[model samples]
Target: MLAGLQNVTFEFGARTIVEDATWHIHPNERIGLIGYNGTGKSTLLKLFAGEYAPSAGTVERSRSTSIGYLHQDLLSFDTNESILQVALHAFDKAKKIERELEEITKKLEEHTTDELLHAYSEKLHEYEEAGGYTIEHRTEEVLQGLGFSNSDLKRPYREFSGGWRMRVLLAKMILQQPDLLLLDEPTNHLDLPSIEWLEKYLQHYKGAVIIVSHDKYFLNRMVKKIVELYQRELHIYNGNYDFYEVEKQQRVELQQRAFENQQDYIRQQERFVERFKAKASKAAQAQSIQKRLDKLDRIEDVTIERPNIKINFNVDKTPGRVLVELKHVSKHFKNIDILEDASAEIDRGDKIALIGANGKGKSTLLRILAGAEPFEGERKWGHNVDDAFYAQHQLEALNINNTILDEMKEAGSKKTELELRTLLGCFLFSGDDADKKIKVLSGGEKARVALAKTMISKANFLLLDEPTNHLDIHSNELLIDALNRYQGSLILVSHDRYFISKTANKIWEIVDKKIKVFKGTYEEWVEWKERAESRNQTLASGSAPVKEVIKETPKASSNGQPTTSTGGANAPINKEAQKELQKQQKMFQQLEKQLADLNKQKAELEAELSNPSTYADPEAFKKTENAYRQVKDKLASVNADYEKVFEKIMTLEEQQS
Candidate 1:
C-alpha cells in the first residue's frame, strides 16, 4: 500500500467528516474521491497527505512510498524561475547530481588526478541513472501537454495567473511520478483539451491516483473505481462514475425497502406488546418482547442527501429572430490575435456551447459578446434582447457587507423575500444560510450566489461562463434541467462535457482566430470531430476523400405527400427496386471483383520491388518498379470509383427501403 486509512475518523470542531472509515490505496489504482461540496472531500485528501491527523484510528503508508498532492493551496508558491525550471525541479536527485557534476568538470579542467577523475566518472554515472541528461526535455514535454506554449515556458512562473499557476504545479506533480497522486479539483483549472490530455496521461500512469473532482465526464472516463464520502462514511463502488450513479441508486432503493420492512415489524410488535401487557399470563411474554424490540438493530429511514431545490428560468421578453449577431468581428490583445473577421449569429432559440483549450480566447470572446471588453468588433443585439452575463469575475459585483439575501435583493429582480430565499436555497443557501454576510462566503459560495443572481434576472438571453465549476454533480443536473426548460437563448463557456451535452443545441469553437460554428448537439459534434479526424488520417495515408455520389429521386408532392417514379402506379417500390436493383448489384459485384484483382497485382509487384535479389538485376528491378507505380496509380483510381459506385448502390437501396 502506498497510503491508506484504517477505520479513520476525522472532525473539524463538532462537525465529523468521516467516522470509522477504512479505505486502502493500492498501486496503479485510478480512484475518484467524490461527494457534494463542503462534504470534506478536500479534507480527506489532506488526511491522506498528512496535512491533518485523524481523530481516531491510523493512517498507514509504506516506508518507501512518495506522494504528490496537487491542490488549490499550492498556488501560494511564488517563484521568479521560469516554468520550465520549476517543472524540472521534480528531478531532485538528478538536479543535485548535476550541480556536483558541474563542479567536478570545473575542477578537472584545472587539476586532473586519478581520484578526481574517478569521482567525476561516478557522478556522471549517477547523473545518467537519474535521467539528468533528459530532464529538461521531459519537463518541457509535460508542460506543453498541460497547455503551456514554448514561449511561455521561459517566462517567470509568477507572471502567470492563478489558473496557469495551478497548471504549472499540476505539470510538476505529474512529472514527479510519485507512488500515489492526490488531486483536488484538478479539472477546475484546465480546459477541455488539457483535461483530455490529463485523462490520457492518468490512464497509463504508473502510480495510484485519487482525484477529487466535480467533473462527471472526467471522473467517468479517468477512474476505474469510485470512493464516495457520504453521511460520515466512505462508500466504495468498484466502477466509474456512471456505474456508481446506477449502483448508488439501487443501493438507496434497497436500503429504503429494508428500512420500511423493519419499521413495519417493529410497529406490529409494539401493538401486540401493548395488548398483552395488561394480561397477567402474557405480562412476562410482553416484557420479553419489549426487551427484544429494544435490543433490535434498527435501520434508519432513507433521506435525500443532496439538496432538493428547484431551478426554474423564466424569460420575461421574447427576442427577435436573431438574438445577437457578430459581423466581421475581430479582437486582438497586444501581439496576440484572438478573433479576426469572425461572423456568427445566435438566434432566438440557440443554445451555444463555446468550447476549446485555454488561451484560445473563450472567456475573452464571451466578454466581447457581453460588451464588457474592448475589441474591434460589431456586436448587434436584436430587438427585446435583455441579456444577463454571469462569470467568475462577476462575483466581485456583490456587496461584501450585505447578506446573501440582501445581495439578491440588490439584483433588482423584484422577488419577494420568500421567493428570493427559495432561489438562494436552490444555490445551496438554505434556511439561515441566506442570512450570512457575503464576506464570510467562500469563493465557491460566492460563485453560486452570482449564478443564482443571473438566473433570477428574467433576461431573454444569458451568457454563462464556467457555471458548473462551483456546482456538485447533482447541482449541475439541476442547472441542466433548468436550462433545458429555459425559453431564452444562451451562449455558455464550459469545460464540463456532461453539462454541454445536456444543455447545448449548438457548438462554437474558436479556431485560428475564427469562430467555427456547428449546428448540432455536443454528442453529434464529437462524433463529427472523430469522423473528420479519421478522414484526415486517411488523407495522410495517401487516400483521397471519399466522393459522395448523388442521384435525383422523384420529388415529393407540394402537400408533402410521397411521390412515386411510376406515376400513381400501385407499386410497392420494393418490387420496382428488386427488378432494377439486379443491374446495379451486378455492376457493384463486377467492380468489387476488379478491385480485388488490382490489389492482388499491386501486392505482387510491390513484393518483387522489395526483394534484394531483384535489385541485383537492373533491368528486372526497373521493370518491377515501373509496374509497381502503374499499379499504385491504378489502385487509387479504382478505389475512388469503387467508393462512388458503393455510395450509389447504398443510396438506391435506402430510397427503396
Candidate 2:
C-alpha cells in the first residue's frame, strides 16, 4: 500500500466529517472517491495528502512512496516564471543531478584522477536514469497535452487565468510521476479533448491514482475501485462507477435483509425473556436468554437516506413549430471572432446539444438565444416562446444576504410558501436548511438552488449551460431523467457525454467558427465523425470516390404523362444502382447477424467462466477460459468490421436518397 488511514476520524468544530474510517491505497490501483457535497470527499483527499491530521488514529504513508496532489484550487507559483519553468519544478531532483554531473565532468577534465572519474561516471548514470536531458521535451509534451499552446508555455504564470493555472499544476503533477497521485476534480475545468487526453494519461499511469470527480463517464473509464464516503463512513466497491452502482445496491439490500432478520430474532427473544422472567420457576432460563440477547452482535441499518430534489420544468405553454432560429449570427470578443455566420434552427420539441472546445462560443450562442447577450445578426424566437436559461455562473446571481426560501420566492413569486418550501426540500434544503443564508451554502448547494429557480420559471424553452457542473452522479442522473421527460424544448451546452447522449436528439457542433447541425444522438454523431474522418483520410491518400450510376428511364412530361425513355431525362436511380443497393443492404444484414451471433456466443462463454462449477474443475475452467478469450477477440474484430460495413451502407443509402 502506498498510503492508508487507520481508524481515522476528522471533525470540523462539532460536526464530524469522517468517523473511524479505514482505507488502503494500493499500488497501481485506480480509485474513485465519491460522495455528495459536504460528505468529506475533499477532506478524505486532504487526509491522504498529509494536508490534514486526523483527530484520532493515524494516517500512514510508506517511506518510499511520494505523493503528488492536484487540489481543486490552483497552487501558488512564482509570478515571474513561465509555465514551462513552473512545470519543470517537478524534475527538481533530476535537475540537481544534472548540476552535480556538470561539476563532476569539469573536475574530471582538470584532474583525470581515478576517484574523480568514478564519481563522474556514477553521476552521469544517475542523470541519464533521471531523464535529465529530455526533461524539456517531456514537459512540453505534457503542457501541450493539457491544452497549452506554445505561446502559453512562454507566458508568465501570472498572465494565465485561474483555469489555465490549474492545468499547469495538473501538468506538473503528472510530470512528477509520484508513487501516488491525488486528484480532486481534475476534469472540472477541462474541455472534451483535454479530458480525453487526461483519461489516456491516467490509463497508462504506473502509480496509484485516487480521483474525486463528479463526471460519471470519467469515473467509469478511469477507476477500478470506488471509495464512497456516506453516513460518515467509508464504503469500498471493487469496481468502476457503473459496477459500484450495481454492487452498492446489492450490498445495501443484503444489509437491510440481515438487519431486519436480526431485529425479528431479537424481538422474539425479548418477548420470551420478558414472560419467563416474570415466573420464578423459569428465572434461570430467562437469565440465559437475556445473556444470549446481550451477547448478540446487533446490526445497525446502513441504509443512507439521500435528500430528494424534485426538479420539474414547468412549461407554461407549448411553443410554435420553430422555437428558435439563428440566422447568420456572428459573435466576437475583443476583436476576435468566436463565431462567424453561425446558423441553426430549433423546433419546439427539439433537444439540441451545443458542443465545442472551450471558448468556442457555445455558451455565447445560448446567451444570445436567451436574450442575455447581443449578437451581430438575427436571433429570433418563434411565437409564444418563453425561454428560461441556466448558466454555469447563475449561482453567482443568487442573493447571498437572503435565505434560500427568500431567493426562491423572489424568482417564483407565484409559488406559495408551502409549495416553495416543498420545492426547496427537493433540492436538499429542508426544515431550517431552507432558511439558511445563501452565502453559507456550498457551491453544489448554490447550484441546486439556482436549478430550483430555473425549474419554477414555467418557460416553454430551456437554455442550459453546463447545468451539471457541480452535480454529483446521482444528481446528474436525476437531472438527465428530468430533462428527458421535459416537454419544453431544450438547448444545452455541456461537455457531459453521458448526459448529452441520454437527453439530446440533435447535436449542434460549433467548429471552425460555424455551427454544424447533425440530426442524431451524441453517440451517433461521434460515430459519424469517425467515419467522416476515415473517409477524409482515404480521400487524402488519393482513393477514388464511389461512383454513382444513372440510367435512362421514362419520366413525366409537362402534361404529367410518361414520356418515352429515348427522349426523356434519366431517373434518379437505375436498375443497376438498385441491384447494388440491395446487395449492400444484404451485406449489412449479414454482418449484423454475424455480430449478434458472436456476441451471444461470447456471453455464453462469459457465463460459463463465471459459474462456480466451471471453476471447481481447474482443467475445464482453463479450457473454457481460453475459449472465452478467443471468442472475445473474435467478437471485437467482428464488431469493428460491423461498424465499417454499417458506415458504408449508410453512405450508400445517403447517396441513393
Candidate 3:
C-alpha cells in the first residue's frame, strides 16, 4: 500500500469528526469520499495531503513519495504570472535539478579531474530520473487535458476568472504526477466537455486518487472504491458509489441485527441480576453473570440515512404549441460573434437539453432564448408561455442584503409567511435561517434560496442554466423529480448526466458551430454515442469490429392495451413486464410515504431525546432512543427497496411507452 491509516482519530473541541477510521489506499486505486456536508470529507482530504495530522494513530505513507492536493479553496498565485508559468511550477524541483546538472557540466568542461567527472555523471543520471528531457511536454499535455487551449496558455493569471485559475491549479497538480492525488470537488466549475476530458485523463492516471464529489454518476464512472463518513465513523466499501450503496444497506442490516442481539443479551443479564439480588444463595451466580455481561463486546447501533429531498412542483398548466421560436438569431461581443444564425423551435412541453463544449455559447443562447439578452434575428414567443429563467449566474445576480423572504416576495409570490417559511424549510432553511442575510450565506445556501424563489414563480415555461450547481445529491434528485413532473416546457444546460437522463426528452448537442438535435432520451443518446465512437475507432484502425446496441422496447399497459411511444415500432413493451413494473412503482411510492412518515417520527423522537426534561424522565429518553433506532432501521430497508423498485420501473416503462 502506498498510504494507510489505522485507528485514525480527529476531533474539534468535544465533537469527534473522525473516530477509529481505518482504510488503505494502494497505487492505482481510485477512491471517492462521500458524506453529508460538514462530515469531514474535506478534512480527511487535508489529512491525506499532509496539511493536517490525526489526533491519534498514524498516517503511513511510503518514504520519498509525493502527494498533490487540490483543495476547494484554490491556491492564490502572483497576478503577473502567466497561466503557463503557473502550471510549470509543478516541475520546479526538476528544473532545479536540471540547472544543477548544467552547472556541473560547465565545471566538468573546465576541470578534467576524475572526481569532477564522476560528480557530473551522477548529476546527469539524477536529471534523467527527474524527467529532465520531457518536463515541458508533460506540463503541456496536462494543461491541454484540463481544457486550456494554446491561446489560453500565455494569459496572465490575473486576467483569468477564479474558475479558470482553479483549472490552472488543477493542471499543475496533474502535471506533478505525485504518488497520490487528492482532489476536493474538482468538477465544480467544469463544463460537461471539460469534465469528460478530465474523467478520461484520470482513468489512465497511474497514481492513487481520492476524490470528493456529490456527483454520483461521476463517482460511479471514475472510482473503484468508496469511503463514506457517517456519525464520526468511516465506512469503507470496495466499489463505486452505486455498489457501495447496496453493500452499505446490507452492512447496516447486519449491524442492526447484531446490536439487537447484544441488547437482548444485556437485558437477560440484567433480569438475572435483579432476580438473584434478593437471595444470598444466588449472589455468586448473579455476580458471575454480571462479569460476563461486562466482558461482552458492545455492538454500536447502526442507523442508516437515506438521500431524501422533499420536492413538489407548482408549475402552471402547459402552454400552447410553439412556445419559443428563434429565426436566424445572431449574437456578438466586441464584433466577435459568439452565436450566429442560431435557429431552433421549441414546442410547449418539450424537455430540451442544451449541450456543448466550454466557451461554445450554450449559456449565451439560453439567455437569448429567455429574453435576458438581445439578438439580431426574430425571436417569437407563444401566447400563454409565461417564462421564468434560472440563470447559471443567479447567485451573483442576487442582492446580498435581501433575505430569502424578500427574494420570494420580489418574485411576486403571494404565499403566506408561514407557508413561505415551510417552503424554505424544505430547502434546509428554517426559523432564523430563512431571515439570514444572503451575504452571510454560503454559495449552496444561496443557490437553494434562489431555487425556492423560482419554485414560487410557477411559470409555464422554464429555462434553467446549470440549476444543479452547489446542490447536494438529495437536492439534485429532488430537482430532477420536480422537473420530471413539471407541466412547463424545460430547456436546461447541465453537466449532470443523471439529471438530464431523468428529465430530458430531447438533446441538442452544440458542436462545430451549430446545434444538432438528437430525437431521443438521454439513454438513447448514450447508445448512439457509443456506436459513433466504435465506428470511428474501426475506421482509424482499418478494421471492423462487432457492434451491439441494446434497443429499448415499449411495453403494454396494466389493462393489456398497447401504449404508443415516440421511438416507433422499435420501442415495444412486453405487457407482463409492464404490469410487474407498475406493481413495483406503486410499492415504491407506498414505501416512500411510509419512510417519510417514519423519518418525521424519528425526528420527533430525537428532539425528545435531546430535551433536558426528557432526560430527567429516563424512561422517556430511553423509549425515544429505541423508537429512533427502529425508525432508522426501517427507513434504510425501505430506501433499498425503493431504489430496487425504481430501477425496475424505469426498465419496464422504457419497454412499454
Candidate 4:
C-alpha cells in the first residue's frame, strides 16, 4: 500500500467534517471520491497530500514514496515561460542529480583519497537509480499525450486559458509519475474525444490514482473503488461508481429495517413498564427494566435528505398547436454568420439537446430560441406559449439587496410562504439561508437560486443552458430526472454526456457551421459514429488487393470485371463486421430502455387497480387490465429479443477475435 488513512477524524469549528474515516490507496488502484458539496472531499484530499494537519489520528505513508496532486483551480505561473518549459520542471530534480553525477565523475578522474572515491561511487548509484538519462523523453511523451500539440508546446503559458493551464499542470503531474496521484474534477473542461483518450491513458497508467469528479460516466469507466463522504462520516466501497450506488442503496435499506426493529423493541418495553409500574410487588422489576432500557445501545434513525430542486412541471392547459417554429432563421453577430438558414421546430413535449464544441454558438442559438436576443430570422411562436429561460449567467439579473425568498416571491408564482420555503429548501437552502442577501451567495448558489425562480414561472417551454454546471453528480441526476418527467418542451445546451444520454430524446449537433438533427439516444449516436468511421477507413484503404485478385481470376466478364465470387473474396470488407456490431449494440440499448419504461407503466397500472374507485367503472377496469397484460407480454418479448441479439453479438465478437 502506498498510503492509508486509519480512524481519521477532522473537524471545522464545531462541525465534524469527517469522523473515523478509514481507507486505503494501493498501487494500480483507481479510486473515485464523491460526496455532496461542502462534504470535505477537497479537505480530505488536502489531508492525504499532507497539506493539512489532521486534528486526530495519523495518515500513514510509505517511506520515501512520492505523490502528485492536481488542484481544481490553476494558480498563477511564470508568464515568460512557455508551456514546454513549465512541463520540463517536473524533471528538474533528475537533472540536478545528473549534474551532481557529472561533478562526481570529474572528482573521480583526479587522484583522490579512498573516502572521495567512495562518495563518487555513491553519487553514481543514486543517479542511475533516478533514471536521469530518459527523463526528458518521458516528459515530452506525457505532454504530447495530454493534447499538447507540437505548436502549442512553444506558446507562452500566459496566453492559454485557465482550462488549458490546468492541462499543462496535469501533464507535469503525469511526467512526475509519483506513486500516488490526486486529481479533483479532472474532466471538467475536457471534450468527449479528449475524455476518451484520457481514459485509455489512465487504463495503462502505473501507480495509484484518486479522482474526484461529478461525471458519473467517467467515474464508472475509470474507478475501481469509491469513497463517499456524507453526514460527517466517510463510507468506502470496493468497486466502481455503479457498484457503490447499489451497495449504498442496500445499506440504506438495511438501516431502515434495523431502525424499525428497534422501534418495535422500544414500544414493547414501554408497554411492560406501564402495565407493571403500579404493582408494589412488581415495582422492582419495572425499575430494573427501565434501567436496562437506558443502558441499551440505541439505533439512530436514518434520515434521507430531499433532492435538490425537484421540479414537477406539467402543461395543464395546452398552448396553440404550433408551439415554436423557425423559418429560415439566419443569426449573425459582428458580421459573422454563426447560424444561417437554420430552422427547427419545438413542439409540445420535445426534449431536445443541442451539442457542439466550444465556440460553436450553442448558447447563441439557445438565446435566440428563448427570445432573449433578436436575430435576422422569421421566428414564430404558438399562441399562449409560456417560455422560461435558465442560463448559466442568468444569476446576474437578480437584485443584490433581495433575499432568496424575496426573489421567489417577486417571481409572481402566487405560492405561500411555506411553499416558497420548501422550494428553497429543495435547492439546499434552509432556515436563515433563505433570508440571506443574494449578494452574499456564491456563484453556484446564485445560479441555483435563479433556477428555482425560473421554475416558479410554471412555463410550458423550458430553455436550459448548461443547467448541470456547479452541481454535484447526485444533484445533476435530480435535475435530469426532473427534466425527463417534465411534460413540456425542453431545449438544453450541455457538454455533460451522461445528462444528454439520459434526458435527450433528440439531438441537434452543430457541425461545420451548420446544425444537423438526429433522432435517437446518445448511445445510438455513438454506434452511428463508429460505423461511419469504419466505413471511411475501409474506403481509404483502396482496392489494391481486389485488383490483384481480378488479374488472377480464371473467369472474367466482357468488361474485364472479375467474377462476383472472386471480388467478394478480395474486398477489404471489415466495415460490414463493424456495422453488425453497431446494430447489436443499438438493439440491446433500445431493449433496455423499453423494458424500464414498461416496468414503470406496469407499476402505475397495478397501483390504479388497487384503488377501489377504479372498479366502479367496469369498462375502464377491463381496459386497464388488458393494457397491463399487453405491457407484460411486450416486456417478455423484449427480453427474449434482447437475449437473442446479445448472444449473436457476443458470438460475432468471438469470431472476429
Best by TM-score: 1
Give the per-residue lDDT of model 3 (tens digit) for 464-505. Answer: 888877776756777787778787788999888878888998
- lDDT minimum window of 10 residues, candidate 4: 556-565
Task: Give the higher-TM-score candidate: 1 or 2.
Answer: 1
**Alpha-carbon RMSD, each predicted model:** 11.8, 14.0, 22.1, 21.4
What is candidate 2's lDDT per residue for 1-657, written digit by digit as tens? 889999999999999998998998889999999988668898888888888899998999998999998986555554789999999999999999888966875664455565765665566567667876468878988998888877689989988877788998999999999999999989887888788899999999999999999888899999999999888889999999999999988988999999999999999989999888989999899999999998999999975566555566667787789988888988889956888887778887899998877767788888888888877999887999988889857678999999998998898548888889877765667678998999998877888888878878888788888888777776777788788888898899887888888999888877657776777788877876675566534432223333321212123323221111122333355456556656655676677788788878877875664454553444574588688778767866876777676666555543442
Lowest lDDT 10-mer window, candidate 2? Answer: 557-566
TM-scores for all candidates: the values are 0.81, 0.79, 0.74, 0.72
> Candidate 1 vs. truth: CA RMSD?
11.8
Q: For residues 43-118, could you state the per-residue lDDT of candidate 1 as single tens digits?
A: 9999988899999999998989999999988888998999998888899889999899779767766766667766
TM-score of 2: 0.79
For residues 536-636, what per-residue lDDT tens digits would candidate 4 score against the true structure?
33322332232332233322223222112223324353567756766766676778788889989977886665554554454575688689779878876
User: Residue 263 deviation, candidate 1, in Å?
Assistant: 0.6
**In order, how many clashes per candidate?**
0, 1, 10, 0
Report the Cα lDDT for residue 415, model 1: 78
lDDT of 1: 0.82
Residue ranges of candidate 4 with Cα displaced over 4 Å? 76-78, 94-151, 277-288, 307-309, 314-345, 371-385, 542-657
